[model samples]
Target chain A: MSILKIDGVSKRYANHTALDNVSFSIPAGCIFGLLGPNGAGKTSLIRIITQITGADEGEIYFRGERLKPDHIKEMGYLPEERGLYKKMKVGEQLLYLAQLKGLSKAEATARIKTWIDRFEIREWLGKNIEDLSKGMQQKVQFIATVLHEPSLIILDEPFSGFDPINANLIKDEILRLRDNGATIIFSTHRMESVEELCDHISLINRSKKVLDGPVREIKDAYKTDTFQIIGNGHLMITSPDFEVLEQHENHGVFRANVRILNQAKPNDLLRYLIDRVEVHSFVELVPSINDIFIRKVKETHHA
Target chain B: MRKIWLIIQREYLTRVRKKSFIIMTLLTPLLLAAFMILPGLLMTMSGDEETVMVLDESGLFEGKLEDKKDLKFVPIAGSLEQAKTLYQETDYTALLYIPKISIEDPKGITVYGKKNTSLQTQMRLENALEKEIENQRFMASGLDRETLDKIEANVKLNTINLSSEGEKDNNAMITSAAGVVAAIIIYFFIFLYGVQIMRGVIEEKTNRIVEVIISSVKPFQLMMGKIIGIAAVGLTQFLLWIVLSFVAVTAVSAAFGIDAAPTPMEQLEAGRVAAEGKSVDVINEEKGEATQAEADEFANTIQDVTQSFANLPLLLILGCFLFYFLGGYLLYGSLFGAIGAAVDNETDTQQFMMPITIPLVISFIMSYSVVLKNPDGPVAFWMSIIPFTSPIVMMVRVPFGVPAWELLLSMALLVLGFIFTTWLAARIYRVGILMYGKKINYKELSKWLFYRV
Candidate 1:
């Protein structure tokens, strides 16, 4: 069953539409990728889901119930804009924020200690946030966001300011959170992360959702009947129905890229190509999620 | 309630632990003592004397003025023009030219000192001339000079105020002490706690901690905790200061001959007695004897003067101070909290703080109004009962007695005023905490107050 739902949500800022007829849902436990370019309304939808901002139209349900003010108690939101009290001590700030999310002092302390030990930040607990580097502060904030074990965790650009190792650590933690039955809404521009971790994906463009589905299903739906043939020859596109888009010679082998006509299958195209060129290799190109995302966004732009 | 207590605890602990707070608490008493006693110490150290050359031209009042210890009067044998010129050449400090005066009208006599002598010197010269004229009149009237001199004596008055219980004490000293205590208490607490609110707000806002804090706790709780915690801190500091002041005064007094230390009233009485004793000794040494009637007259004058002071009503003064200090702090501390919440930056606070501060200043300036009118009169009654003016007006009424009911009513009203203002301030704080960027004005503030919970 869906744990969180956004039904026909639309938001507008004066004359500009920020989110247009957006509808989506997250099932019980999965890493959901919210992918978009700049100004793509990803942040807007994330804000709506987290309840930081209200949607101009539509309703959000948490745990199959209408979302209310108190529902935020179960939602942990780490906004893109870094917010932490720079003058406060590391451990004190984390515990305070945890308590605000409804954790008892002893519970907050235990959770904070576990996270601090995991992140190797125990030495920095007594130090002021200002004394730490930006990455260290981000780590503290991330720990604060997740310390209460909220049911729905929304992390916006969580890996923005980290080195590769720390980024991987956070990535591992995100997966760990999802594995432990928490619904995660991860928003980012990093398509590679989407390829590795996302079970479901949503792509929004110009204040509208252009594409969304399970990562595998969306990739399959956009797959074209094109062939990647690595061989010695390129077939001439003599038929009006078929065409060769481009050709390149790679290390004593000719690689041809082509798109077939409608009603034609990849097997048929391969049968035709085998007779003309040395069939060193023939493979159908299944579009990666990134390619599908770019193509669909560009298609929407043109439409 | 628990969260508010936590907030209060943190604010109190953090502030009290600061070095600045400790330093300020200790430094204030030292500064106050310096202001009170520095002038007297400087005067004693200087101990300078003035020399005067008296030129009497008419020869009618010769050898009239006596040379005193601090002022040395010399009778010069020279004309007025010569004496004035001779002073420019010689180091004669000041030349006083007293023309021979008609015994019928003493106003005809003139006094001249080169380059404007001091007021003290001028008064001394004028007094000497008057005495000389009187002596001349006494002799011409066929009065026995020795007998009249024997009879003349300075009388000092002593006062005793008998309460309903028949307890006698000096009222003037009590009133002065009460007024000073009240003014100092109100001034110190208002300043100390008011700035704590400012610093507390700035710390939260500057560190961006207020965002998280306000999300869970109501702005009212946060602001209330801070104001109360800081007030508690101020009260603690006040108690400590009183203890320190007493210890310091005692230590210094002991170091400089404790035997010489007398209660303030006793010191005043000793001053009167010493003056009388010195005058009598001087007269007895000069005239060879003084009769019985002269001493009795001197004693009567001293008794009467002391009696006026001792009869003053002091209980009223002490009560007035207690009412005013608590009232004034509540009225001002609420404003200070409001100011704290209205602005995001410290620089922006200045614009919003003026209206609240001006009334406090006006109340202090018009404090004397309470003293001049009836202490329980309509004007003093209204000003003291009103929250804004009570702190200062109540102190001014302490010197004059006030009715019990009026005092109790004013105290109750001021307490109610603080509660209402604090509630209003909490409203502003709630909206102001989340509001960033735009400058807040009366219109915006009113809208914030009217916003739905």
Candidate 2:
């Protein structure tokens, strides 16, 4: 079942239409990547689901029921532009945010202490946000976002400012939260994280959804029916069944891309390559989400 | 409701705990207390009387010099050198040497002092000599002191206001002062606390926490919570000031056995008793007698204040003051909050501030300049009725005896105006707080106002 289902969602500003009749659903217990380039209505759609804004024309359902303000307690959002009260202490800010999300003071305090200990940021609890480093502040903000243990979490550009180590830490946390039965809507233009983390994604472009499906399904749909073969020497193939798309000879090593035509099979190509040169490896070339994102956006641009 | 309450609590607690708040709350009372005792302290600066030895070579003015307040003259029948030695031996402030010169061309009078004498003492000595010489010349010209004293005419104008009740003593000075004071306080508080609301909005917006906050609670909730919180803070500070000042003054007065000075309102009764039908005592209002009753006048001044206050409608003015204080803050606080949401920083607040503050500024300027001068005129009447200006203009007009119907109408309209501005501000605030880096203008604001939220 979908954790969030948005139907016929449309949002328009004075100068432009931010989201144009966008329709998608985020299934329960899955990591859903909300993919789009900058200004492609990704934030607008997330805002609608979070109820930070209202859809001009749409219906939204949460947990098989219509979405309402009470559902806010069941959701956690970390916006693209991360911020905390600069003058407020880390512990106070966390508890305040937790309470705002409908947690009681004692409950918020307990959850905050747990998160602070888990993040190893207990030393920063008493310090003002302005006194902490950017990375440390991000840590506290992350704790604030998830302290209520919300079932559905929305993080926009969650790793934008993270260093490699901290990004990995957040990446691990995101996966862990999803495995713990929290449906995650990870919004970003960074396609690599999507490829690694998302099981399903809906790509938006120019205020419209250009692509939507499971990550592997979308990748399979964009495949070019090509295979990359790495062997000892360059193969000079003259067969009409298998077309040599490209071949490069690097220091007596042969790397070639070949597309199988009709009346040919992958096993047959493997047999032919083995007969010709010593076979090292043969794998079908699947498109990356990054390539799919660029191609879809460009296609929409041109259309 | 709970969320809004939480927000208010946070806002109030954070501000009340600030160092500046605590410091200001404590310092103002002490300052007021110090000011109350400032005159007494000045008197005690040289508590003992200082003696001045006069070496009179001009035997014509032998033993005529008299003692002044805090100044005594001792005539020494000796040379200037002996008088200088006398001044050095004793703690005499100064020694005056008058040469044998005619009254027509009096000169060569020198004051010798062990130390530089105070300006007050020197002025008093000079005045006494001038007066004595004038008297001697007048007597020589065949005019006695009694006749000259009678020739001095004194005019003490007492303004009596006639009303339907009857003719009564009216102190224009006291009433006008009350009006100006009320206008100034309203003007000052609106700006002081209005900017606080604005800066708080800007802070949340700039810090980017506004987004998180609005997500959890409605924008209107946050705005109201902040406005109410800051108002509470302002009230807390004011209440603390009043309570602390009252307690401190009462304690000091009890300890020192000194009566507190009269408030402006209380001075009206003193005006009535001290000024009305007192022409028989006009002859004693001379320079010499004026200097003698220094302490008596202070007590009399306090009495005048107490009576003047008794004459005015104290309960009505105070009740109206409290109402307008809160009403004015609410009215301007919401608008200031809206401006804070619209702009990214304080520098961008100028354009929006102009329209919101213009009426307040105009009312403040006219409340004293025009309304006080002509309290019953059309300008004062209209200004007092319009809610935007009424907080100050009505306050200025109230002490000058506003009609009951007009007061009620102005108050009712003020309530409606505050409600309307708050609703308008909430609309703009909900949308503007979410916008980032957008150059918001009046047109954009109007658009946000109409957006179907």
Identify the CAPRI category of the predicted complex in candidate 1: incorrect
Quote the RMSD, in angstroms, for model 1: 8.1
TM-score of 1: 0.66
Q: Which regions of candidate 1 fall more than 4 Å away from where they truly are?
A: A2-26, A32-75, A95-107, A160-165, A186-303, B30-192, B255-342, B368-424
Interface RMSD, per-candidate values to 1 decimal: 4.1, 0.9
- Candidate 2: Cα lDDT at B450: 89
Count clashing residue pairs per candidate. 17, 11
Q: Write candidate 2's Cα lDDT for A1-303 as tens digits.
A: 889988888999888999998888889999999988899999888888888889899898998788899999999999998899998889999988999889999999998888877888889888999999898888888888888999999999999888889989998998899999999999998878767889999998889988898888898889877899998965888778899999898887889999989868889899888888987879998888888888887887898
TM-score, one value per model: 0.66, 0.89
Question: Could you give candidate 1's per-residue lDDT for residues A113-144 as a string of tens digits?
Answer: 89988988789999989999888888888888
Q: In order, what lDDT does every prediction score?
A: 0.71, 0.84
Q: How well does candidate 2 reproduce the true complex, by DockQ?
A: 0.57
DockQ of each: 0.21, 0.57
Model 2 ranges with Cα > 4 A deviation: A297-303, B34-40, B46-48, B56-69, B88-90, B97-117, B126-169, B246-298
Give the CA lDDT, 0 to 100, for residue B213 in model 2.
80
